[model samples]
Target chain A: MTVNAIQTRRTDPYSPPAEHLELQGDEPVAFLDWRDGRKAWAITKHADVRTMLSDVRFSSDRSYPDHPAHGGYVPGAHKGAIIAIDPPEHSAIRSRVMNEFTVKKISLMRPRIEEIVAEALDAMLDGKSEAELVKELSLPVPAMAIAELLGVPYEDHEFFEHNTAIFADSSHTDPSQRVEAIGKLRDYISKLVDARMDARGNDILSRQLDAGLDAEEAVGLGFLLLIAGHETTANMISLSIMTLLDKPDLLQQLRDDPSLIPGAVEELLRYFTIAEVGGLRLATTDLEIGGKRIHAGDAVYGLTNTANRDPEVFPDPHTIDFKRGARNHMAFGFGPHQCLGQNLARLELVVVLEQVIQRVPTLRLLDPISAIAFKEWGPNYGISELRVAW
Target chain B: MSAHIVAKRETCIGAGQCVFADPDAFDQDDDGWVVVLQADPASPDAIARAKEAVNVCPSRSISVLTRPEPGAGTGEAG
Candidate 1:
């Protein structure tokens, strides 16, 4: 039995680490060895990955030692962090706030989201022909959106976005800096939750409070949203733009037909599958996956990045096709813990692409894709900086 | 025969793919459970969207069933 070491380095910018993709073909459910001496199962096939994720037998509870999903942070200890819990508890907390992100609710946010995108673009394109797209556009759009969603005051936006960028983009900062940012953001959210308790508002935090969530739970929920909402979306925003600018033909496809932008966004998500480790689980009971019998008490990883490229599910999986309508991809993940803000993310991407393509006729990448710094070590895969000019 | 959409709310994880697929046919209740707004799709576009909803639903909570149209299936039809 051969155990392949988890490969984090990507030989190609548009694909997962080569070893993982190789494993997807040679051994779809391969044994894995982690750098920290953790032995686990890595499932890379699309069907198997979905089965592993949707089954409650594969526990998501991260309280146990050697849970592979932690990535050095133990969010399982945090109250109301639904992503770290399972079953009734996870559903209980998720239900409390899920309504805030419903398709109807998020769709209602389109006008405001468009305004936010326009504002970010306005700032980025104002009095300038070139700017680093990450700092100028990608970072701020999602940051401001999350801030408004949480009712973070206009005055605190700078502090909130700054700390979140440092904390979320772990590849760019030292552990201590990331820790400091988390601490600062936690304290800010705690204080804000306290303020909300005294006087409520129409925001997610206040709504959670109204739904009988105590201060700790409210703070935990708010903090999670503040971090999760912006960082992943911000990364997606930049990566999608960078991919577009890198491939002029693809970019021209969207430019030629604005209607293609939405489909292109889904294809980009499938192509990138940013979350390197998709659904990490601990087997609660013996189960068979991909014709391999696994006993209880084993750690498992559903390597979704590679799963997205599984040739069986996606024909010519390596090729990027905008019309593929790859909605079934596990990019936002699957099952109970699937991304709650997926609708919002899609809306933001569509609006951003529409505005960027329509407004910035000369937008071009200032650096080659290979020259760009990819966040290889981080929990999410994305570009650290995208320099672009109009 | 017509295609009818049924969503099992208990099994839904509120992924919202149903609504994404066919907003006219599905929605999320206030607590974010799946709500079927239209049980029988009227248009080909709507039926196609209903099928897409079934395809993308992560929980397998949605099913599209085909049954005879109301009066046409009855022997006493006018």
Candidate 2:
């Protein structure tokens, strides 16, 4: 394997490095990732990434000391979480909670999600011409939504939000700090799980309890959902807003045709495939992908961001095209472990974007795009604070 | 019109695009994999909806085969 053949770099947190984009083609490139200080294959082509994601031989268990991870944190304690497990067990655990995320199920929550977005918008735009959209609108919307969905009291969102931020932020180099944060979040969720066991409610935690999951397992599921439910969609919202404002014509197009919101959301997801470093998998057995032979125990990073921009699948992949049909993008990953909360995320994005565009007509960035502070060290790429004026 | 439905179970990620598109023809199993509800759907609307489901499947797991028209067929039906 040639280490110099590919070197992954993120000069801009929002966009994949030019070197990564240039390596996209029918072949998988081998790269030496700085984070793990390990040599791994970077799968950049769209089809190759999809195929690898579905192949059961490629495992998602990050407990393996050699597991390819952005930061030194392996999150090994999160093994019970759906994202950290393989099939059979993964299927069993995920199936119990799958019904909650179905299109029909999430659609039922649309009115509630809209209400949350509206409330956040009202609070943000109450008496001020300018506000940090990330703090005011993006974060709280999904945070409250997930809190309500999990039957956790929304008043405690600040606790989980702060802890989740530390856990998800890649820049927080202290592994012990992340572990402590996870421990606190897990303990908090365990308490909620215990409370639900005594008095069940209609929320997701109560439902998991009904499914006969043990307290620890239930708490694991709750932790996974709580962190994933809010952090990902929140980042997507902030990034989408940033991308939308940067391109005023696209914003105007969305403003004129609200029907185009769904399509626009899909396009934005493809344009900004924010799952930093894609989904990392360990090759359990020898495999061949994109004509390149992968050895057993090799760490293969599915470069979803680059795959979304593969010229072979998407024409002029770097350019944002709202008219383009990009629903096939790997922004959500693929295969059995494809994002379980995708339907809910899509619903949240549509509602939030529609409300912001329609209600906040005068919304514009307070600073230049480059001036915005982006969370470069997070597993997900998004702005830390988006100051906007109306 | 009659339609035959098939789901490539291995590729299905349980996105529920098929069930969402045509609940009559497709449903998810306990493990959330796609399960064909009606292999030989009788209604043209059902067949059309099944095709729509096949199109929307993120994993492209669902496939529909419609019986050939009576007079236009050369060999076998279904």
Candidate 3:
């Protein structure tokens, strides 16, 4: 494998790490040789990534600006929810909204998630073309699901989608540009939180008020949920359709047994693992992991993208199998920091894909597989455009 | 050997209960997303730690997993 300046100076819009651990034993893992000058160790193995994430020795402070995913951001302008910190600090902020992420909390919203998916799919199939599926089906499902969860009206989705795109797409732009994008999202969220407070209802925002977060923290966490909560799933919906269309057998299988869509979605998540890197974590102190020493204050990205592809855990690592034995992959991370929006994502994908196949039986890619566009990184791995014909 | 911990990411909901229950073993990322340190849940001590993290999580977005491997030992072990 080549490790040259071109790899390091990645400028293909956005890029997920392309490095892979050559599998030998039943368990093979490696660490990326990260850039120096405030750089931290990047743990890529399923084992190490899982360890580093839960290890209290690692911190998630934005002040460090350490993890590779945050590789190019400017400092001082960064402030966010506890998803960026280790507790007792992380706990102080997250405790305020813990109940909102539960199965029970989101169960009520499943009907709404279904409604949005139905609406998007109906429009998508009604007038077929080589449209950008990402903008059509992928973007809307999550945006609408999140909009409902936060009790934002469907009319407000354009604003929320814009704010989330700017916030989550930080990995793609220059440091200054990223700073501006984050500022815009924060400001937008702040206004939304205030409007909700004045018009308090039984939504998550109103509930968060009872927990004592002022306008800023409440908005920060709210913005976090809106973006991280659905963006990943949106990509999965678009990309997994591409994945299945490529494997018509799997798609047909899923079409036949709708129950399998949920498990199939899990399998797809394990196989594709859209997010290339776990969000960045800072080593709180010196540590030896996977036989490599990681010094304190260094940044590291738990490369979940790599971990999900580890051959030892997954046979023929690159293949997408519907019945793989070790299907549990790091697509959602692990430990205390595991993904909160996971079920919501899973629920959305299962329902969307199921209906997409049911509605459009001949949903084959119109363009050559090579013509399908994929975002290189940015917690999104999906086609910018997909032309489907039934 | 690397230290290990077990988590059901599908069940997790950024509750931060695991963050407080066992500060050494769990945390959230920038958007209140859970980042698991370990997921094997092999050792008894590790299993206990995971159980604590799972139990305290207000969202109950966690589960205890015990490794079937014969060599598995206790306390944050791989």
Interface RMSD for candidate 1 relative to the native interface = 1.4
Best by lDDT, which number?
1
- DockQ for candidate 2: 0.33
lDDT of 2 by residue, A1-390 (tens): 233323444567556867676667434555555344557778888888888987878998766767665233334355367787787888777767787776667778999999999998999999989998877888788877877788767678788667766665445338888779878877888899899989998898888778878888887777777667676888899989987888899899998999999899889889878776546888999878987889998888888888888887789887888889656688888877888888888999999999999898889998998788776655677777889999
Query: TM-score for each prediction?
Result: 0.93, 0.87, 0.75
Model 1 alpha-carbon drift over 4 Å, by segment: A1-5, A35-37, A74-76, B1-3, B41-48, B66-78
**Best of the candidates, DockQ:** 1
Tens-digit lDDT track for model 1 on B13-55?
7878988788899988877899999998877688889888987
Error of 2 at A298 (Å): 1.1
RMSD of 3: 7.7
Candidate order by decreasing DockQ: 1, 2, 3
Docking class of predicted structure 3? incorrect
The residue pairs in collision within model 2 are A170-A377, A171-A377
| Residue lDDT tens for model 3, A118-200 | 99888776756445576678878887787777777768777767655554444444667656866776676678788977888
Question: Candidate 3, which segments miss by more than 4 Å at Cα?
Answer: A1-18, A23-33, A36-40, A65-80, A158-187, A325-327, A377-379, B1-78
Error at A116, model 1, angstroms: 1.7
* Candidate 1 residue lDDT tens string, A190-260: 99999998999889989888889999998888777755677788889989998888888999999899999
